[model samples]
Target: MFSSGHLSFKGRGEKWNSTDDGESIATEISSVTKLEVLELCGNSLGVDASLPIAEAMKKHPELKKALWSDLFTSRLNTEIPLILKTLCNSMIVSGTRLTVLDLSDNAIGPQAIGALEEFLSGPTCFALKELYLNNCGLGSAGINVAECLIKCHEAALRHNTIFDLQVFVAGRNRLENRGAKALAKAFKTLGTLVEVKMYQNGVKQEGISALAEAFEDCPNLKVLDLNDNTFGRRGAMQMARVVGKLTKLQVLNFGDCLCRRKGSESIVMNLAMNCSAIQELRLNGNEIDVETAQKIVQMCKSLPKITILDLQQNCYGRNWSILVSHFQKPFVDFGAESDDDGSRDGDTSEEESDKSDED
Candidate 1:
């Protein structure tokens, strides 16, 4: 039942495949006098169902959040683009200024990027603050997202408004160097991003360097999680060079990034010198040596607001006591130490694992 301008069919496990199902949902949607939030996750929606729902969406210009993740479970890839196009176009026509648009876990491939281009580049998304596309399998087509965002920014400028996108999450998308660099360009243009999470995307040094440069433009950035990426020495150094600029950064997750001892030292030293608001820091499974890990803990002590320091699955040897002595207030997570060779079987964090299972 819809209540308080909010309607949710989340995790209903119903498959709305026919026009009759679409009309039934549309009738309920149109009946909401002031629909502001709609949650349609955990249910399968086909093109037939989407058309009527989109038409119903046009009646609600007050819509703010569209939580529509995991909506296509067994549908054909070809049908997804049309469904997205119809729904997003209706919102655009309704003159809704969406703040949060979560389409995560949908496996919307490169082909569907076109469907979202018009909606994102138009005035409808001028107020979009949070965009979630995790596990969408964007691949090389992520460039289209960047391009659409750039166009959105341009449209905002033309309309004398601001496209202040704050949070962007696109993990597990396999967006390699090409996709990352493209989004970096868009991020540089927006310059209002607060948090950027792109973990497990196979981004290497080249992509990371571009993103680091883009981060220089985002002075208000607070959280940056690039876990499970390949950020060897050069990438870490590049990121270190820009950490001084992001003085407002609070949560930094570089876990499983393979930022070796020297690279880790560089990043930690820079954070100590520049970022003072850092609260949570995760450097697990980075091949950090005992000496460098000690140095990291010693430096982190200077960060007044430091809370969570995760140094798990590294080569921390027998000096656990020395590291634990540094932080008595903040909880330090020092998972099982790695072998002398700094080898671990699985690098997925408990948090990431939980999220994966949930999605």
Candidate 2:
């Protein structure tokens, strides 16, 4: 395969858990000096076989992208933080152009998140972008992780320069109020973050307040996801106050948030009143009262920038089509998922996994 030179797995993903014989494949991969992208996610390989293969790719200056999903590889027996430290100090430091890091479903806890917090929180990570930390089980109940981010702020902000950011962190417990509060502090410090997801964490009123305040500063924050959380009336009200301030907010998903229609009304009206930046809005799984649905439909009509509206699972389902018809321009139905428009990237994938939490 190395001699053939048709080395392209560009769009292939692991729907089938095919383990290409590690020895020969690793040898071939190690020799390729011009590889632009490499993804070794979700295979049942041991760290004993994977570490050397990853280390071998370090020599290639042209290597720019990598996806190392599934944390069980390195965390089989070792503590997660130590493994992250090792990976960051070794592979991350050498790849000057490396941009994407997908560490989803590895179950890295608050300790690992805290350890990597310095690596990503401040200015030390300027050239890097696109971080996926989904299902890592971040800390939700304490302030240590949050305090650690504040402690590392100066250089973490100065060096962790990820201008083109697209972060995904979900399906974890550590994203509770304290953990989320810590993350919000770091978000405020960042310069050019664009997208974020912390769905299903226990991010209550205080965390949303912090996020709302931080949201005012992030000039590039366009898409945001806070689905399945505890951000309720006061939190939604806080989000309402500043939701319009984000001139680039295109997509928003607050699905299944136990919030009453008032919360949705507060935010949706706030956005409709001022933010021409919003293109897609999701109120799915909320117990939105019919009055709020009517308000949404009325407001969305004037929103020239809006292209997609999702109100599925809201108490007002049949009326969903009523509001949709008033939209003169093309708009999505409740479950329609257009191109990377909203947070989920597609309706089916998000619906199936919408119940899952994030941070």
Off by over 4 Å in 2: 1-23, 71-86, 92-95, 111-124, 140-153, 156-168, 171-173, 316-359
Query: 191, model 2: CA deviation in Å?
Result: 3.6
- Leading candidate by lDDT: 1
What digit string (tens of lDDT, one per residue) describes model 2 on residues 206-315? 77788888778777778888888766666777787877777788998887774556777888888887878788898776666456666777788778888887776655
Model 1: per-residue Cα lDDT over 183-226, one tens digit each: 99999999999999999998887898999999999999999999
lDDT of predicted model 2: 0.61
Off by over 4 Å in 1: 318-330, 338-359
